[model samples]
Target: MEATSSNFTLSTILKTEDPYSSLMLAVAALVAIFCYFWIQGKAKSKNGPPLPPGPWPLPIVGNLPFLNSDILHTQFQALTQKHGPLMKIHLGSKLAIVVSSPEMAREVLKTHDITFANHDLPEVGKINTYGGEDILWSPYGTHWRRLRKLCVMKMFTTPTLEASYSTRREETRQTVVYMSEMARDGSPVNLGEQIFLSIFNVVTRMMWGATVEGEERTSLGNELKTLISDISDIEGIQNYSDFFPMVKDDDEKAPLSLTHVKSLLMDMVLGDSIVEESHLPKLPYLQAVMKETLRLHPTLPLLVPHRNSETSVVAGYTVPKDSKIFINVWAIHRDPKHWDEPNEFKPERFLENSLDFNGGDFKYLPFGSGRRICAAINMAERLVLFNIASLLHSFDWKAPKGQKFEVEEKFGLVLKLKSPLVAIPVPRLSDPKLYTA
Candidate 1:
């Protein structure tokens, strides 16, 4: 270019400016040349594995300005509708990929399971969990594995669940009795609060029941529940710092029918007694209902959000290192390809099928899949199934007058019904003494 352009002669530059101008010109020329080559290099990258296609991001904010945190999972599913199974999304300066298909889910969760195994800890997570060192947000390595191992040994095995059966049974029976009393008065019960309290007691007892006793346990339990509730709300909030971490600037369940309500209610509780843990396996229908419920409404729809520790290829696309990974269990669960009449509450799909809570079949992950799957799945299954069976067995539910039953969901740190359920329990058991027994 210097040889071809007569107007850009060295003599002209020397004649026009001060001596310092020549040096300035030289520096500018070098920068221009460097930029030309850099552009060429970036252009060449397009020929290689491309990033999963997604909505076009704005200059610096990326897609941060577009997201609505209140309805996050639904928003993600909508984005996937246009971007295909594997969708790339940019939040602030960070990159995130949403996996919406079971095939894509398998690629990230199974084929490259270890690659995207690290939890993408939020700002609150680090603060609450002491710099995210706890098992929930810890990286996939020896330390985290050790913590998980300890938890498994302490509270998350079949043997441990069996040992704690009495506590679960006791708590569950008390709930039935409470409902029965409510039934006698024809008082409406908030089943949500009831189930949560019962589960909370079961969890608290299993976690530290042996350590704390009497009033101290009660006090601690109450405090723990409040703190947990607060923590969940805090964790759900969208923080500006989290979106633009490099930029310092500021600103910015249940229940039964005559014998099978929703397929979830079963015959296990038909006798004059509360459902027992021993009866769980004997009742395949109860298990199917559990599976169906989870499929329709996953506890954590996005599965706690994974992050790739290293650059990886997922579904033939370049998923860069440090990319936040979201396995959209909600969408995948309702995929028409895998499930027939996916929207319907059909438990029979799981009856003859071999799918279990182990996360083997990627198509139905109620408790998630891969190494980061819920550590206490055994305990959870045992607790939930037994409680649900017992509830359905003990009484029949009747929604208050003029209140329509709805399944609308409101996602948060956990998924919940948009409107809390208010239903009255009508005793279904043959013997009235069984309510207290």
Candidate 2:
């Protein structure tokens, strides 16, 4: 009887242990399920303010599938219709806030400027711009400030730009002579090619103190053209990694690798070349031309993407921290509200009105606004204006046979003529003595 009682006690202990084990397993299962749902809820929360609106996105991919690789601007504009000017979009998992209206832009660029001073450089942009070392691509920080000071005080100051005027005048004279010869020969000149060469020569000389000549010049010019063309090409748009940081995919890493390769190439070609210090006067006409070109064809129509430093409200919408922001300078420049016949190519508009391209004025922001504006503005403006004025003063331009001057634009980092600015050139109708004098 005692043996039987002991056996019953052992059986009872085994039964009790089974229930405890089962209970632990059930608890673990419940916790796992809760975690899965909790993670999903956190992701959904990142979609931004619900009332502001945006395109519907797919799981993981987001709205990336619907984006047009060629013309991002068109897609952005379409979103504005459904979501209003302050619309949110998901490129992969990343959240971007597109600002299309002037009022909204003014709020972000002017009223709350300091809060939006940081720029986000994409992988592709980082590669072509010397790992964001170039003035145009640098982010907002101490490095950016130091670089800006260098460009302004040393590279593009009025005195430095003016010193290069004689070189510009000489190049202009050559352009006129070449065109005059072409006109005399009755040969059709590719005006686009001519203009590009003239600008290339002027910029190269000023930057490096060297003139390209012979086969080397031709090859170098072609290489520069290819680099610029590649930068503008839309085929390289989708960078999955930029938007989805948590997903460790190989495709996302490809752009970063490509950027490294480009940096190496740029360093080999244009890195060591530096500008020397010299006393000179500033050329006002040249400065004007550069500003005008940038106005018409900004390197990045939207400029560098800026992220909000803190959660803030803009245009009646709550923008969370780390949200990608884009400013549509293209639409702003063409806005009928700010400009007269905004589509017209009128450089004289500046002379006729008090409008300026500096970030101080919200109406014309080719270099961008606030602390994140391009550091190379001063230098770029001087280079562009000097080249444009020299070409125009030296040569009279005409369209090719039966080809009218159509101002159709092609989008890129820099806006270029869709068909290339090819034209016939004639020498400026001026006396030789006057030109020499």
Candidate 3:
């Protein structure tokens, strides 16, 4: 086991009478990678609560070689089921803890809320989010608090949201009119596309006011969405540097390139009563529908990931400082212990309960919890509720002929429909003016 420099020489290790120089260099790299992990394992803390149990790691690569990043949320759910709620998995040199149960989630997000306040900043996230200085990824400190306050007080305050009421109503009106046109033409519309555009317009109008309008504004929104989708696609790819930042990544064409991997580890309903923002309070069933949809499909399934600022113990397991933490809200939302008939889509069940996006309930945190809860909850609720109600009240949806309706999802960065929804909207409103702005 002792060192033998002669054994690693180009001629000796390559075992070729005339070994190519690049081949010799590649062989040398393999030996170095082996040594790096060996030293890292030995250098880790020996005294601490033992790390949570997980699948056995393989040499230098760790548990990463076993993960399928495309289905990482579901994959983590499966792993946590077998390894317990708090499971530790090594992604290269990076130690990550995945929490899938409500008890463990509370311990991480509530009990040790401050310690786990920061997100595990991925490389793609850094570039897209101004080197991770944005509110979502900024470190837990006064600066982040200021940003949050600015968002809550100045930006998303009730009065401010109320001020933008007309803008929201106008956008929803446009969507209603467009859908009405589709109904008149007997055409099937892509619900996802139309809704995204409406939401996009609402957001832009709120930000830029009515200064930008018509095709230019729509073009801007389309461009922005395309840009975001590109970023999401890039984030979905598992980059080796993210896992092993210690090792500099060579170009993809290199003999030992570790980059640009295709696979990597990383909802709505409607109803009708009044169908306006002011009417949302009285329409408990509509609210329940939104809650149930969120439960089944939490936007950021892992809640942007939490990184422990210091060594901590949660549920009798050690979570080392700076380790990546993932609370699988998707799994917790569907846990049978907390939710009866969790997998089934039952909006009525929510009608009996008081769970909501306020982030109080650990088992159903669609918008996360504690200080890190989403900044624009007020705006989001208004936009979502109003739009859903408007869509349902104004249109009687019909599936494309001979096609079975199904809701399948593909998870990464954010949850996405596996296939786009195609439905025809038959007008169901009493008066045509209700559909106008």
Candidate 4:
């Protein structure tokens, strides 16, 4: 058997069972496994849907260089047009499946929802949120469900929101007073900053009766705004460490460092009382405006990258296990094929349609869909509606003289206005005393 060419096959060598022969057999087995996968991959390329079509990736950097920080969503949307709706992108060594079309979004978010419920956060996100322990980054299971239940039952329920109306009204009135003084002085006001401050005050007041005054409040508000802006900026950045986990992400010194994440993540407002939930039914137009805003600018452009627990087929393509899935809601929301005048700001489109933020509708998932959908939808809706309504009802807004108001958006963890909304507010209320009422 040792000398004969006829018995030189691996089976004969393995059968010899000598120490050297055994070592040779082990090496042969490893080679066989490697070749098997190589041949299988080649066959799959010919016979299976090829990892969904995608733009050719470059070595090492992959598609990283192509994504600009200011307009990453736009860049990704452009790639979808060239690569089809469901595109495969390589970010460093990581493989990301980008679902751009509503159909593809449905597949990832609905049809195979459970299979892709878990999120894969970047290293900075993990370190900031305490190893992704919070509901947003938490893996789907009992812990996530408990958090979701707390939000749905204890925090954002209709009754809880209704009880918060007094706080909402109080804060809204304060904003009105501030705006009135601005109107009297004919001074330009940063509407975005104003709205943010009003909402922040209302939320904090409801949560713990927290109050700030004078220069201190303004300083704190500016700091919080900057913190939010920084978080959004970091969330949009493509950390190579996420794509190549083997590499140290420099978590302490990363563009989105652990410190920044801690500051943003640690600041949470626990609240109960807010806007009258009953009034929501009557404010159809407000809801419509929200829908339109979400359609144009979903808070989370990519909706926390989902990861499949097991390999599965989506849109006829083979999705390997643990592959990261990016549901590009921003791209889907602006697809011309789905909505007329997709890029235009038209709340009227939703006035006649039944599309909503609920996870059921594939064509319009601003908050997302499936088991991993945003848990704070109820609270968020009320907060946004009440704040916007209060701003509109208390004063009429117009851009300051010679200043043009534009809807240009900056992409981030949450979409933001490229410029702070600067406007002149004219008092709408009949009596100045009403501001305190």
Candidate 5:
């Protein structure tokens, strides 16, 4: 009876107070505590390092709601006053590290360039730019390198631009004659359309071996203009897919939904196929005009988002890996630190200076910088310069009756005049002699 009682007591003790079970419970609780802290630390870090500071962000959406659609640059400038040049703002879920100062821009573009080289194309930009096949829209890779090289060597070569010089001269001569005729008739001429047409003629002729005067030119011109207009509008950027990918649902109707709009626009412009190289000049000035236009009026005053690929210090702050980066070429170009009277219209700034737009100089990268700089730089520049030069040399321009040269700018993909540039044209008697031969 004594032994039995002893065994029963031992059994009771084992059942009531198990050492192994208690130890296991303690271990599980410790693990849960550790995991909680770890997750919290990670979340804090993802919010990014202590940035230069800006307006407070809401949960999830961040400073997006605070952003004004019409005056994006102005809004950004306002934030700059509170937060120094290098500041951070969250646009929806995306983190935007804006570099308003030239010094910080230099560091981002020059020192730690590779980290910020890849581009993230917004959905609207992608659809408008031909499924991102064109050099400007393409990401950094073999295709981009190949295209870039081809553009430099075969298309935009000094010899190629020189060869196309006569094309411009001829176009200019025609424009001068047209203006002279219009002046003689005393009829109101749409100088803006004339200028646009003249440039378009020259560029298209060089690219596709046809001028805008051709039978199909009107249709093509309308299509091209529509495409450009759609791409440049602010509403395009306001789409939800650009900010919140998960919110895209076919059944849900939202102001920001882009599905139908993008589809229709793409159908009208890209309709049926890609734009082949045969459709464009294999040379540079054709590309240059495009680049210059963007510089004058960048499609996005701020480039797409970039991330710090590696941990590094910039402008005295520790820029951790995956930290968002922005290069404000618009502000940088305007800043006295890099440019003089940056607001003025001066294509001569490029010609006068040794500064090239190859992402080397932070002062004039309309296309952004680093590994992800614009793929279409070579082509865009060639097109823009070719056209601008062609128009200026071809005609002597005058403001329409009672109209002054208004350079009021409207921002989009490229800066466009708030009012399409309308002017009067008086033909030069001796165009070739009056302008540089």
Candidate 6:
């Protein structure tokens, strides 16, 4: 009976030959071949210092769904509780390393500074900044060096800032006048918007020298404001293509798409520009306020993702070549280990400590560290300090009726107040001349 059954099976296999069955066998054989190589590769990688520990990822999307959009920095900080300070997380196909402690930050920003100086520019950043000509996303090379030198020598030097101090004061005085009128009328003002306008005007005047007050200035300011807002929105959006570069979008490749945004400066020589830096000993408190604000809410919370040029070990863990690096300054700033009361808004902390945002101290690198630090640090400092001081010194502020003061931040390319600050400004200055536009 066993011999008869074997003969019948052999005869059936010889008699039946379907095209579908042949194709199925072929596909099965290919799959088996692929699996063999895949398993072999996995076995080989096991011998190396494995990629930093991270939560289990799904098939394709990775750990993106786990991130909270409203507060991405806080979500990342929460992850550190499970996976140590230097942990790995996948955003789509991309590998990302989150550095949350001062030690890890020092390694990436100071020790291995040259290795991680290259930026991982987003599609929007490349499109908006004229093919990455601007200093923000430019690669580390001779061109970048030239741009940095020009910025330091021509624009942000102490003499240049000092030359333009009068322009800042003039704009601040105008803002005071406008706020005083609003105070007299008992109307609530959008404090954040007002502050933005003041800073924008000061920076523009410093860059473009003098301009007549008319529809031209208003039109230019409004246009620049809209462009800036749009750029910010594009920058902060979670575009999957940024992580998975194989994906393409029509708009990103389109011509005449935000190619020449007039306000973005790299090494463009503007002969008429005038801002000369000077000693600011009297404004020590003003500087502290800006520093405190930055610590609480860095403009770029994840400090412009960096790219490792070669395979490197960071914090005793193997960081593969071309891995994305996110130095979570936001998380580091709020660490209880480094700060006394991490959540509090105490500007006095800066006054007590000698920590400056010049990238010297890893514990508080709001601007960043080493060679790729922000090129416009001096100008940014002056603009922020002047704006804050002018507003605070000119008026006493209170929340609008029926509104309570709250500190909330929204995730974006630049940190912004979740709720635009709406407050009533009460003029404190006695001299009527001080309020003139």
TM-score, per-candidate, Cα-based = 0.82, 0.70, 0.83, 0.80, 0.66, 0.80
Please write out the lDDT profile of model 6 over residues 304-406, one tens digit for every residue.
8898898787776777777888888899999999999887767667789899868888989888898889878887877765565556656677767788656
Candidate 5 versus the native: TM-score?
0.66
Clashes of each: 1, 8, 1, 3, 36, 11
After the best TM-score superposition of candidate 2, give how far the Cα of residue 270 lies from its true spot, in angstroms: 37
Task: Please give the CA lDDT of all the candidate structures.
Answer: 0.78, 0.62, 0.76, 0.73, 0.58, 0.73
Q: Which of 4 and 5 is the better model by lDDT? A: 4
Q: Which stretches of candidate 1 lie over 4 Å from their true place?
A: 1-48, 210-227, 248-269
Better structure of 2 and 3 per TM-score: 3
Q: After aligning candidate 1 to the native by TM-score, how far in Å is the CA of 421 from where it should be?
A: 2.0
RMSD of 1: 8.5
For model 2, give the 10-residue run with minimal summed lDDT. Answer: 273-282
Q: Report the C-alpha lDDT of model 3 over 1-437, residue by residue, as the tens digit.
A: 34686466656645655558667678888888778755654455456656788887776678988898778989999988899999989998789999999888889889999999998878777677788898988999999999998899998998999998988888888888778777888999877666777887788778885533454544555566568777876655556777888864411111110111101100022232235577677667667767877888888888787898998988877788899888899999989899998887777687787777887878989999987999988888898878876776677777789874566777887887677667899886566776654
Task: Give the lDDT of residue 301 in candidate 5.
Answer: 74
Candidate 6 lands at a TM-score of: 0.80
Model with the higher lDDT, candidate 3 or 5: 3
lDDT of 1 by residue, 1-437 (tens): 76768678678877875869978988997787667644643563465677788887665577888988768888888888888999988787688889998889889889998998999888877778898999888999999999999988877777888788888888888778778877989998777666666778888788778433334433554566557667876776657667788754400033222345424435423456657787777788878777888898888888888999888877688888888888889998988889899877777788878998888888888788899988888888887887777877777777788785666778877777777767899997687778883
Off by over 4 Å in 2: 1-51, 129-131, 190-193, 214-219, 232-236, 248-299, 344-352, 430-437
For candidate 4, give the lDDT of residue 77: 89
C-alpha lDDT of candidate 5 relative to the true structure? 0.58
List residue ranges in candidate 3 displaced over 4 A: 1-45, 211-224, 249-274
Q: Is candidate 2 or candidate 4 better by TM-score?
A: 4
